[model samples]
Target: MAQVLEFKLPDLGEGLTEAEIVRWLVEVGDVVAVDQPVVEVETAKAMVDIPCPYAGVVTARFGEEGTELPVGAPLLTVAVGAPAAGGPAAGPREGTAGGAAGSAATSGGTTEGSGNVLVGYGTSEAPSRRRRVRPAAPVRPQAAGPAPATAPTGPDRTGARNGNHEGPVPVISPLVRRLAREHGLDLRELHGSGPDGLILRADVEYALRAASVQERAAKAPAVTPAPAPPAHAKAAPEGIRTPLKGIRGAVADKLSRSRREIPDATCWVDADATELMRARAAMNAAGGPKISLLALLARICTAALARFPELNSMVDMEAREIVQLDHVHLGFAAQTERGLVVPVVRDAHARDAESLTAEFARLTEAARAGTLTPAELTGGTFTLNNYGVFGVDGSTPIINHPEAAMLGVGRIIPKPWVHEGELAVRQVVELSLTFDHRVCDGGTAGGFLRYVADCVEQPAVLLRTL
Candidate 1:
């Protein structure tokens, strides 16, 4: 007998609550191996491939690609255990599952799955079978019996105004419960629009809105409703609307929070980068691992941060303290097809030019390929935004939220400038530093920018601290 075991979407760490399905690797009736990536999902942070822990013939798949599923929602079901004679059991072996149950499926050993899964799958229970996608028109939950509903609490649980009989509430997310509790709305009275009887946040909100409408309607006198707009006005020009979700949504949220919370200030300077460019060209010509210009700039940044440590920190507003970190995890902005992602290099203060170049290359490749992990996307103490690649000269970049400062570098172009007192064409670059005003005043910010400008003009200035 083949026992079908269902797998749910695991809790991807870093407080991520949901994921939008991007692609499915396998189909129903296809055999999959244990730990083999089954689906690619786009969370708010990054793109990740979820691997199933059970090895068997895929019996069923849950959602279509691009469907947004909450954590713990059913992903698929796999048939485990032995088949009678020459069924899916005798097919080509994909790979074995963890232990005994896999042994039975392949070698007629024992039953029961190994339950050994990845790190994020910690105690994630198998979700009940509820596969239908919610249609736009509201549908009431169909149950084996009437799905048991919890009665409303507090003083509002009186007779006709209260919820139904008390029992289990089919809600998975704590956030949904919190929203309902705060509004004093009865979850049992509303029809759920989720899989099975699961009460979602949208359902609660809809119920609240409906109640408000009814309350207002009851107090007002009956009147004729307004007519629809004329045909000419209805046929007005329309525009393409994109849903703000996934990485784009995350960027929108972080940037908005940064604007709301951080009291930021920007300062800029133009530097003759003739020396910095020469230093990089000379380093490559000498033939040791080729160093990137970004690496050299990062080296200068670390050196400048050592002199002015206040810039390499985040302010704790609630604690009323400016928390200065001892180590620097430098984040650099990389624009990709997906969106703009800032990949961080850990312990950047400790890396040399050669090491920094290698790490930057690795991260940039990952960013372009959409394979960067959440860990690589976060934990940046200070950001370095080189907007020069776009062929622009200077921009006052918004601070990457929670981080205190971001340094922007503009395109290095040949321009007429005074070098050693005579007019000449020099490689000039603009450097802009944006800092949280709460962390430091104008003097500290100015000194930091000046030090960076000095380093760009004379590369040897960096060597003193290196």
Candidate 2:
């Protein structure tokens, strides 16, 4: 007699009710080992490749590509147990489940439910069954049995289904559930260290760290887990309460916080950037990546910060101290479909023009692709927002959180300016800098702006600054 096993979609991240199945790595009739990648799913944060947790001959693929399957939905099936007699002896082969690996399956097809199991026998725990796609509408409750399993805490718990209680109410600790949910670790796979096989938070954390190491050693890079949306994230029947759970949501929250917390003062100046334009054109002609006016503006900001260290400080609201940094890490406001992401280029004060150009190029590309790491989004000493690309004149940009100052660059246009004592059409750009008054005085801001203006007027001044 053959034993069958099913693989359901495990929670891939926190409270993720559904996930878009991007691609299937395995097909029907393929013999797979435990922990081998089976499918790739695109969540809000990144594309995650899920690993198979069973070793056997694959029999079916329940969820097709592009389908948004809920957690605990059957993803694939396998038949464990003996092979058909007179055909081939199917016994446990080692190196797969720590149980067996055998020759690939010969015949199979993608199906919705169980089908055509054979006579061979292989052994493992019975596969966890899948829940129905949609739960029946809740009737008026007569009586309650027990509380259901809580959602896991991390990004990996994305595909977790709604409440289902069938097993003996497991004694799940709060932190364990939080760790499992946050990291997307499947609680079912973890053997508990607590009494009565109760999994502890430490056990889950250990498993996560160990598995991450193994994954890295196996050449599969661990993806940055997107933070979970709030628990109260729900859609009302009358109006939608979409969770700000992804990159766009994050950007919105950060911008809102900055605007709320920072006491801002805006200062504006206009500068002739004719030489800066010429330098940019020369760089583009010499096989550079066509670094934008934004890059030039960023370089100037770095120089300005060097002259006035107060602008490079952050208002420490919690400690009521002004935290200052010795180095400049200038963050550029990169606009993406997921709203705006500010990816910082560190040590901008130390890098030359070409290096700054390349770093900004790579960072912005990663931002647009939604592949930027959490580290890339943090640790900026100052920020620069370029509205020039959008043909805007100038507007005060709100400073990013904690950071005391932000510089906004406006569009450069050919305008009449005093050049060699003659009013001639020259490239002119507007600059707006908003600083927290608590950290810097007005004189410092004015001097810094003048320094930046001088650098923009003569781009070669940056060569000496570097």
Candidate 3:
């Protein structure tokens, strides 16, 4: 009889029920080596490529692209000798049970074609299936130097650093990968507590938050109540309120959580935007598309992040941690026909004003057309919401969830002001920055807003900061 070996989709991480297929790297009949890239999967948090562990000829794809497959479901089947009659194994494989893995090895004996499959990953339960059992203890390699004393001692692998391992291996699903990438976490370093060492999305989130807290102690100063907003009459409701269903819906949830969970402290600064307006007009005269005050604000925000790193941070409420980011992925609120959208500008600190303006244009157009993907909407460190576009003076804007702060930009209008002890008309814009009181103090928020104002009033100041 011909023997066949089946490859089931392992539980990429703990608590990862399902994953969406993004792309397939291999085709049917292609000879793949162990650890070769075979498929790409997308979870809620990130995209990860799965490598093949056993070398064999490609057989068949589990389903079409974008298909959501449950954990332990057979993804592909490869024949070791003569091909088997049935399709890929259905349900969790014998040793690969996610929920109750300890009982799998003894219950199902290894068959002739079955290879040593890692248990504790997910697999379907079927009567005909056999379990390939390995040694009780996993063989871990030693490092060249003495192991760090701070290594966590636990059954969970999250805290365990894997800087030593190499080679292809089966792992958790897309959601776990996404969570790890967003929080700048290392999945390999994490010692998973889930069945068979599968890292769960929640596990990654917990690790990230723990890391963030350590950073906050190093950055944040003593917290103080933010200065109160200037008293004004109940502002008449003039703007439209649209329902946020998709991208906007996500934004709403994030902001609501930030406000409800974290203590918010807001501060204000007035900036003379005359120089930025003149600079923009000159650029437009040189054949560039006319950039708005909001675009100029984006450039200033990016520059500010480079000068003050603490402003670009995220607060983990559950972990009681704060993570300061080095890169600036500036997110600006774009009001479109659909609703309010904040398309992110990746690595904002790396791009120049011209390049930043161009990128905003592209993202805005894409967002308005309803073509932005999930990746585009993820990974924002700081956000800018422009109420000026609709001709408002200013209001304390809510912070985006996860992030610690958001800058609100108001309209630039000619106003009477004293310059050098003389009353004159000057172009002025109100800037408000609302930050999580738990993560940042009043002094830090004030300093950050002042820096942004200075950059706006003198656009050339960015030359040194950028």
Candidate 4:
């Protein structure tokens, strides 16, 4: 008889706790080889393909597309020792018990066990023969009355009374529960729309939004007049909503934490980048591999950090000590359609302009394609944000948390300036430094920004450090 093995969602690393099913590659009863990708999931960091470790006939799939499953949740179940015949399993024969045994006999004849170790299962050992059993039923959310008929509701109203409910709440992520508790919203009062009626973060957020709207409506007077419509009609419906669950949510959480925890301050300086622009043009003209403007700025940043190491450090709140890093793992912010992502270049201080240019190009392409791995998106010791692409003059950037500072580069445009005691148009750029005040004071931050400005004003200053 074929033994059915369950495959749970593997840990995609980088502290990701859950992933949403982007697409399913296999269907129930499809024959699959070992290490074949069965599903593609999108985590907060990136999209990952999950491979099935068992080589057999797929008997069941757990979640549908667009459903989010927590780590260790069952993804699918494969019946090992099934017939090796291509296509779905055949119906049971006269001697077979419920056709499962016959399907196993047919598929198991030629299928070999996979030695791969997935998130929750290890296939290194010899296969054990066991009868296929049906999985236990999942906890279903109690059906609630009709809500606004706009979106899905959460738990029922009386289900949460006195916390005396018998069964466990059908919530998946702890984050959802925490959010409801923080907002004083009862989870049991809303209905869940996820598979098996599992509560999702979006369901809670929608409930909260609905409650807030109702409360405001109650407070407002009933005699208010409607305003005139604008020239262009709204594209979306009145109650159209987008969930902040994936990359957008991750960015929101990080930025919020940074604001809440870091004592940050911003300093700005206007620098004449004429020399830097000229230097870049000259290098590209005489270069084997063309150097990028961002690369030049990054080289200058590494040199500046060397001179003022205080800014290249993070505050260890638990130890209550400032941790100064020796190597610069440089992170550059890239804005993509999905949102803003920072891809890190490892040991950036040691890389030359050519290497940095190549690395930046590779990472930028990957970022645009949404193919950057979790490793490439994390472990940034320092960040260099060039917001000039947006045509903005300057901005006080929020420091990527745990990183002490972020250097923001503005658009270098032609502006009237003093050159050789004569008025002339020069390429001027604004540089802003947003640093964690806990790691260093304004004086240190000023020194770092000044060094960077000096290099921009005179590229020759960077050559000495190089």
Candidate 5:
């Protein structure tokens, strides 16, 4: 006798409320062990594998690949109990529900539960047996009900409208409910397009738009004339439409918000990086582990930030104050097939060039593989953008939102410049700093950029801070 249990999508931390199914690891009727990954889902931050807490035969699955499900939505159902003799176990027999429940309670082979606290399951231990209660008999319309001319069919509609719905409202996000309330729309009047009739934000928005159009039509005159297109004009062909979702969508939102909210300023300078290149070569020639050019630049950025702490801070709009951070959690932009992700190297100020190089390499590999966790993708204090790899000479990078500043580095190329008094071919690179104007004025921004340029011109300048 097997007791069926339902497992819902768990919260994958970092304030993520929904995830798109990437792949399914288990199939219906397959036996799964406790803590086994059942499906891989892509959230806004990263791709994650969700584990099943129950060990049993998978009875049913909820969503197909690429289907997006909200947190607390049913992912699958598992039939738990001992396997039947000499064959795959079967579902519980009808009318033996009580007997099977009792048997499962006393069964020695059954697992108590997997003590895992993910999104759906809490920290509490798993219950020994699921409580089964007899459902009330369905209410049938009276034989004389044919006399009524106006009776509603299907699931109760007036429950949500009258605010007396007993069961769950099918809506997942609070933001969706808020949107409906603000527009004076009733959630009950809408049909959800999601799985199991779950209400979504788009559904609410569409209802609001429809309601607005209806209201305008009722108030306006119906006999208005319309204008026609010119005979010389031609209809446009439809283009391929790509959905703005997942990582690309997240990037779009963040960049748009930064442009809308932050008052930013950009300053750039070309520096003779020949000395820095030579110093890096010399260090590699005598070192156990080779130091990377990015690491050296990162070290310089940290030193520059130490001198001008205002750049290493964020503006707290709610607090109406600038929050200056003591420690530097440095973030570097890495481009992958998925998209551009800035992986943060925590406590970067305390790390030496070698350590920073190693950490950068590790994070870059993780980013390319799409295995970087949500924690690795957030909590950045200041960002260092190395656009040099893209073969670009200069760019005014949009500051990563909330972070006060971002340092952009361009490709180092050999250019004719004055060495001492005479002309010489020297390695030169363009450095740009994009800062939040609200945090500091141009003077402070110029000083910070100047220090970085100085370090590039003479690597020894960084030794003073070291």
Candidate 6:
């Protein structure tokens, strides 16, 4: 007898709560194998194919392409084993119990299957479905249930009423907590709209906007606040209004968060790269595998990090401590058609130039194809951004947040430079280092930048550490 089972959209890690249906690989009545990819989804992190855990005939698909679904929403239903005489599960999808999209009427006992879903996510046990509750006015949510849409408004029912409650706030995403902390919003004072009273980014943002509006309203009588310019103040310009979602939205949120939370500063220096370029050429000329210029710069970065360990650390605000990482996982900025992504090269401090070049190549290719996993996309200790490909001379790079520093490399072009007391057309490059002021001061930043410049001016300087 066939036992029907349902597959929910599994959690794609890195704190992603939702994904948009990019493409569907299977249709109803299609036979699929265990661990077969059933759908392609675009999360804020990347585009990935989601494999199903169960091996069965697809009985129904839930959401259509382009539908943005929260994590754990029903994806499809499958009919396992041989069919019953009437074959009740062979028909089109019907609504499931509790208003979930797909039918669960034919669902029986749990069936064991492979749990591989994504790199860091697995889907064996069913996850709870997420629902957005739009209460009349948000009530201080309890961990047990959601507030009704007709929740009471006014100070009497404000979240501050539960401020005295002794329990940890229900927040699963670190990003959401960070966003709230940046704005000085108390999590206990905001009602979460996620499942089981879980706090989400949207909830924090909404609360901040509401607070902003109220602040202006409160000051309206004291002063002529909330400007209403002359009748014709020029309507806001409008063009194509693209919804910020997927990778683009993720980048926007992260960059904004970084600017909000981090006190960062930049220092740049111009260097004679004649010897560095010549060194790379020499290595290639005598080579097993050609080393990339980026790899050489990366080697210099790792060596400098060893000398100035403060630049290889992150500031832990809550713990009031500086975490100096022993190993470097170097991330390089990659621009692809999808968007800009940073793929980290693990144990970068230990690897030689050849290994770094190969890993960078592989990760870059994966990033361009939108196939890089969540683990590959995160856990960067430092970043190396080569903006030279754009033919630019320099830029004050924005430090990638949480990480203490970033090294920016500009065009290594032929310029008239004074070398050994003589002016000549020599290869020159500009290097910029942006560091978090909380982690290190200007002196340390300067020393790190100077070390990198020294390595570029004289390649033998790196050999001392090598």
For residues 243-353, write the lDDT of model 4, one tens digit per residue.
888888898999999999999999999999988888889989995999999999999999999999999999999999999999999999999998999999999999999
The local lDDT score (0 to 100) that residue 250 gets in candidate 5 is 85
Task: Identify the superior model by TM-score, candidate 2 or candidate 3.
Answer: 2
Which residue pairs in model 1 clash with each other? none
TM value for model 1: 0.75
Error of 6 at 177 (Å): 15
Per-prediction tally of clashes? 0, 25, 19, 14, 2, 0
Q: Write the per-residue lDDT of candidate 6 for residues 126-245, one digit (tens) a residue.
A: 121222222232222122133445433222213443355676565434445667888998888865544434454566777788888889988876655577789978998889897889
**Which of candidates 2 and 6 is the stronger one according to TM-score?**
6
Question: lDDT per residue, candidate 1, 120-227, as tens digits?
Answer: 332121111111122223221121133235423322311142246576455534455657888887666654443343455556666777788889989999889899
Instruction: List the candidates' TM-scores in order.
Output: 0.75, 0.58, 0.51, 0.69, 0.74, 0.71
lDDT of 3 by residue, 50-162 (tens): 55544557777787886767654556654333334675422232223221223224222211111233233222222123334643533321212332454333445337565
Candidate 4 global lDDT: 0.74
RMSD of each: 9.2, 16.0, 16.3, 11.6, 9.1, 9.9
Sort every candidate by TM-score, greatest first. Answer: 1, 5, 6, 4, 2, 3
Candidate 6's TM-score reads: 0.71
Per-residue lDDT value at 3 in model 6:
52
User: Which pairs clash inside model 6?
Assistant: none
Write the residue-wise lDDT of candidate 2 on 1-466 in tens digits.
5555655554433233345687899999998765678887754434456666455688889877877675445678766546566764342232222132111111220111111211111111111211112112221111112222442333232223323535522322233465577888667665443322334445666778888877887996667988999999986578666556555555677779988888889999999989989988888899945676666677778777877898999877788899889999889888887677788898988876677888988998887776665446778889888888899899988788878888888989999999999989999999888999999789988888888988989877877767
Most accurate candidate by TM-score: 1
Q: In model 5, how large is the Cα lDDT of residue 103?
A: 19
Cα-lDDT of candidate 3? 0.64
- Residue 358 error for model 6, in Å? 0.6
* Model 1 error, position 48 (Å): 0.5
Order of the predicted models by lDDT, top scorer first: 1, 5, 4, 6, 2, 3
